[model samples]
Target chain A: MLDANKTIQLSHGGGGKEMDQLIKSLFFKAFDNPILRAEEDAAKLQLSGPVAFTTDSFTVSPLFFAGGNIGKLAIAGTVNDLAMMGAQPEYLSCSFIIEEGFSIAELKIIVESMAEELQQSGARIVCGDTKVVPRGCADGLFINTTGIGRIIMPNISTQNLSTDDVIIVSRDIGRHGAAILMAREGLELESDLTSDCASLWPMVEQLIAANIPIHAMRDATRGGLAAVLNEWAKASNVGINLIEKAIPIADEVKGLCELFGFEAHDLANEGTFVIALPREAADGAVEILQRYGHCEKACIIGNVVETHLGKVVLTTPWGSHRYLDLPQGELLPRIC
Target chain B: MLDANKTIQLSHGGGGKEMDQLIKSLFFKAFDNPILRAEEDAAKLQLSGPVAFTTDSFTVSPLFFAGGNIGKLAIAGTVNDLAMMGAQPEYLSCSFIIEEGFSIAELKIIVESMAEELQQSGARIVCGDTKVVPRGCADGLFINTTGIGRIIMPNISTQNLSTDDVIIVSRDIGRHGAAILMAREGLELESDLTSDCASLWPMVEQLIAANIPIHAMRDATRGGLAAVLNEWAKASNVGINLIEKAIPIADEVKGLCELFGFEAHDLANEGTFVIALPREAADGAVEILQRYGHCEKACIIGNVVETHLGKVVLTTPWGSHRYLDLPQGELLPRIC
Candidate 1:
C-alpha cells in the first residue's frame, strides 16, 4: 500500500489496490454523495428539458496563487460558463491529471478547495477520473471540469445583442491576468492585489430571478474584455461603442498593465462578467449587481451602435476614438 | 497569425484570432453539428429523466497506437462508461491540454479520429475547450472527455449481483495492455497484436435491446478482469468462482503476459467487458455477445457463490483453487 502522506506514485492511478484506496480515502470522502456512492460506472442524474453543458481545462502555472488555486479555477470556470448561459449550475465532473512524484498533500488541498467552491453554486461533483503520469511527463497538475445545468433563461447568446442595448461590467477588469503575471514574475506589490477568480452562479441566479431581460452574459476570461467585445460585435453583427472612462480598472492593475505594456481590457478577469440588456433595464441590473461584495464597482461601460458593423470603437477620456481590435499574439499564456 | 501547417503556439490557445481560426478550420470542420455551431459558452442539450454522466482522462503515451489513438480512446472510454450503465451515449464534452510546440498536423489527426469514433456511438462533441501549456509543462497531449446519456436501463450497479448470477467475458482479454507495453518497450513480435481499444456501446445497446436481465456490466479496463470481479464481489458482498480454463485469452496476450511476468487477468482490456446475468440467461447472453465481430470469443467464465464472501475463487483445470486478488502495485502506468 502506498502512503498518501508521501508523494503520489503510479500505483495510485493504476486502478488496483492503491488506486482504490486513494479514491475511497480522498475523492469519495471529499465528494460524498448517494449517487457517487452507488459505484456505477456513470453517475445517474435526473435532469430535464434544455440543459447547458460546458467543459474547461485549467493548466495554470503556479498551481496556487493569490485568491485561488487551479482547483477552484477549474470549478468556477466551467460553472461560470453554464451560469453565463442562464443555466442553474448543478452537476460537475472533475478530472485530474497528476504527475508522478507530486505531493499528495497538495492534491488533497486542491481537492478540498474544489469541494468548498462547489458549495457556492450548490453544484455537486458527481463523477471524476484521476490519471497519474510519470514525472516530467506533465507539470504538477491539470484539472478538467465539465458542468451540466438546467437552462433557467433561454436565448441568451452573443448574437442576441441589438441596437440600444446597454452593456454593464460586473466588476473591475484585468485583475486575474495581472495577478498571474505578478506571480510568475515573482513581483511584490504593496497592495493586496489578487486574481478575481470566483464562482459567479449566485449572482447569475439572482439576475435570472430578478427577471432582467438579459440579452447576453459572458465572463471576460482569456483575451479579456477586448476579446469578448470583439466576439460579440462579430457574432451579433453590431458595432459597440465604449466610453473608455466608464470601464472600471483598479489602480494596481493599471500600474501593472502600464509596466507590462498590456492593455487592461486585454487582461483576463475570472470572476468579472459583462451583461447586455435593453436600455430600460440597465439601471435595475446595475443596482442589483451592486449588492454583491465583488460587484461594487459594477457600472455601465458600453452600448450597441449602428456605425462600424462588426467593430468596437472606444472613446478615450480625452475625446479620442480608437478601434479596440481583438487581442492578438501571446499577451499572457495560462492566465486562467 | 499562427499558421496551421506549423507547430501549435501560445496564440493558438489564447482565445484570439489564432484560436478562433483553429477552432473554425479544424474542430468545426471535423465535428460539424448544429448545437456546436450555436457558438455559446455552453452547449444546450435537451436531456430528461435519468441520465448517465461519466468522465475519463486519457494520458496514454505514444498518442497513436496500433488500434487507436488518444482521440479514439477518449471518446470510447467515456462512451463505454455510459454504456456500462445501460445508457444511450448522447453528448460529450472534449477538453484538451496540449503542450506548446506540439504539431498541429498531429492534433488534426487526433481530432479527426475523435470525430470518427463518435459515429460508433452516435455521440456528439457538443462543447469543448483547448488549453496549451508551455513546452515541457505537459506531454504531447491529454484529453478529458465527459459524457452525458439517457439511461435506457436504470439501476444497473456493482451491488446488484445475486447467487444464481453467472459471469461472462465479452471477448478475449489483455490485448490492450500487452500492445501498449510492446509499443513502449520497442518490441517486435511476429504476431500482429493490436490494442482492443474500441467503442463498446453498440454491443451494449444490443444487450439492452435483447433484455438479458443484466445485473451488472463493466468494461475490464485498468486492473483488468481481476479488478472488476473483485469490485463486484466486495460491493455485492457475494463470492465469485471463476473457471480459469474457461476464460478466454488470445495467444499474443498470453505470450506477452508470460514474458512480462504479469497475469493475463491483471492486464487491461479496453473493448472487452464482463457481465453478471441470471444463470438461465447466461447462454443466451453469450450467444448474443459472440455475434459481434470483436466478441467472437465471448463465453461463460464464472458464477456467483454464497461462500468466500467478498472474494474471487479461481478453479484451475487441475481441480486446484486459489484466490484471485485485486491487482497490487503499479502494473503499467498510463495504460489507458
Candidate 2:
C-alpha cells in the first residue's frame, strides 16, 4: 500500500520494482479488467469492422477544477473525439508523464476520476505507460489518452454538410474555459460556474439511436465553436449564418468573458458540441438533446447557406452581420 | 511558410489558425497520407481480427542523442510494442505536449525524424493532437504515441514460456543507457558508442514469415535485459538459467557499467529484444536475426528450466551462481 503522505519518485517510473508496485497497487487496481490484467506488452483486443482512432494530450493547468480534473478531462476529451466521429466509444490507451515529487494521494484521486469517467462511455483503458521526469522537468502531471472505437453511424463528416443543413448547439458554451480561468485566478464568483467537462458519448449515443441523419458533429474544444464552424464551412464549402442571440451562453460564462475581454464563442467548452443535419431533422435532434439534463439549452443556432462559401457569417442582434473567422492568437493556454 | 527563426507560441496549440498552420506546414506535410489528409476528429480505419493496442509517452532528456532523437524513439518504441505482440505495425496516433517558446526549426527536425522512422515499419501516423503549455511548465517537448495493429501471429504472450525454451537476444544490450549517460556526462569515449535505437518490426516480421514458433518476445527497454528476463520468469512460472558469459555486452558499455557501479543487464536498450522459443528453433531465429547488420551479434543467452520457478539464476564465468533479481531503485531517470 502506498503511504498517504508519500510522493511520486523517479524510481516509480524506472521500470523496476518501484514502478511495478506503483502500477499494481494503483493503476491496476483502479482500471482492473480482464484484457488489461493479461500483462502483455500490448493489450490484445478483438476489434472488427471500421474503427475511429483519435488521440489527445491533457495539459490543463490547475489540474483540478470545479467540475473535473485532468483525469476526467483526459478520458472525456479522447472519448468525445471518437463519439463525434459517430463511433461507439470502446477502448482507450492511457499514458502518463508525471513530475517527480507529485503527491501519491493526489494521483490516486485523479486516477479514480478516470475510472469513474470511463463508465460514462463504457470505454475501457486497455493499455498504458508511465514515465516520471525529474522535479521541475514537468508540471504536476500530464495525461495522454488515445482511443479506438467502432463506427456505428458512418458518413457523418465535415464535408458532408450541405447548404440546406441546419446548425445546432448542444448546450451553453464557454463554461470549461471560464471555469479554468476562475480556478487559476482563485476567484470566488459567487456563481456556480463549473467546467462543462462531461463525457459526450452518452448524449451522442442517444442521437445515433434516434437516427437523425447527422452530417457533422464536433465537440467545441480548444478553439471552441468558432473554430469548429470555420473548419466546417471550409470543408463543406458552404457558408454558416449563425444568429448571435440564438446561440446559448450561460450568464456567468458571458460575464467572465466580458471581464477577461474574450468572446464566449471563442472560449473552450469540454462538453458542448455543434451539429449539422438536414433542416428536416434539426427539430428532432434538438428535441432529443433537450431530453438530457445537461443539454437542456440545446437549440438551432444557424443554418448552412450557399452564399459566401467557406465563411462563417454571424448576424448580431442589431441585424448587422460579419464573418466569424477562425480564432487567432491564444485565448488561453493549457485550457484542456 | 513557417518562419525558420520563429519559436512555437502558445497559439500553435490553441486550436486556431496558428495551430492549423503549424500542423499543415509541418506535421501534415511530413506524415502525408490520405487518411491523415482527411483531417477528421479521428482517423477512420478498417480493421479486422484480433488487434494489438499500445501507448507510450517519451520524455527522454537531451532530446537529441547520438543515433536517434526523441521523435525516432517515440515512433520506434510504440511500434516495437505492437510488433512484439506479433502484430503487423499499422496506424499510429501521435500527441505532442510542447513547451512554449521551443524552436520551430528544432520541432521540424524532430517531426522529420519521426517520419523517417515510420518508413522502417510502414506504419502511418493517422491521427494526432497538440497541446502547448507555458514556459517553465514542461521540458522542451514530450511526445505520446499510441498504436494499433492487426495481430498476424497471435498467442505470443509472457505466460507462454516452458522448460527447454531457448532464450535468444537480438543484439548487444545497454547501449542506449550508456549512450544517454555519455551524452549527459559529456564523456567522449575513444570508441564509437551510439544508441542501438532502431525499429524492430522488420526483424520481427521476418521471423514470423519464417514460421518460427515464437512463444514469447519482448524488447529490452526501460528496465533492460534483467527486467525482461525476470518478468518472463515470473509470468511463465518457470525458472530461467542464463549463461552470463554468453550474453553479449559491448566493451564500452561494460566499462561504463564498472565506472558507475551499474550492471549492463540493468541498463536500457532501445532496439534490442529477447526471445523465448523451443530449443529446436533457436539457431534458426539467430540466423535470421544475424541477416540484419545491426543484429549480427544475435545469440542464445539462456534457457528455461524447472529448477528455480519464478526466478532467474545467472551462472558467472567462473561458475558462481546467483539470483538475478528485478532491478531496484532508480537506475537512471528519463533514459528512454
**Model 2, position A286: C-alpha lDDT score:** 92
Top-DockQ candidate index: 1
Q: Give lDDT tens digits, candidate 1, residues A119-185.
A: 9998999998889999999999999999999999997999999999999999999999988888888
Which pairs of residues clash in candidate 2, taking residues 3 or more apart in a chain or in different chains?
Answer: none
lDDT of 1 by residue, B279-336 (tens): 9998888888889989999999999999999999999999999999988888888987
For residues B202-279, could you state the per-residue lDDT of candidate 2 as single tens digits? 999999999999999999998799999999998899999999999999999998999999999999999999999999
Interface RMSD of 2: 0.9
Cα displacement (angstroms), candidate 1, residue B242, comes to 1.0
Cα RMSD, each candidate:
1.5, 1.2
Best-performing candidate as measured by lDDT: 2
lDDT of 2 by residue, A1-336 (tens): 777599999999988778888999999999999999987889999988999999999999899999999999999999999999999999999999999999999999999999999999999999999999999989999999999999999889989999889999999999999999999998845779999999999989999999889999999998889999998999889999999999999999898888989899889999999999999999999999999999999999999999999999999999999988877788788898
Q: Which runs in model 1 stand beyond 4 Å of their true positions?
A: A1-5, B1-5
Q: Itemize residue pairs with steric clashes in candidate 1.
A: none
Cα error of candidate 2 at position A248, Å: 1.3
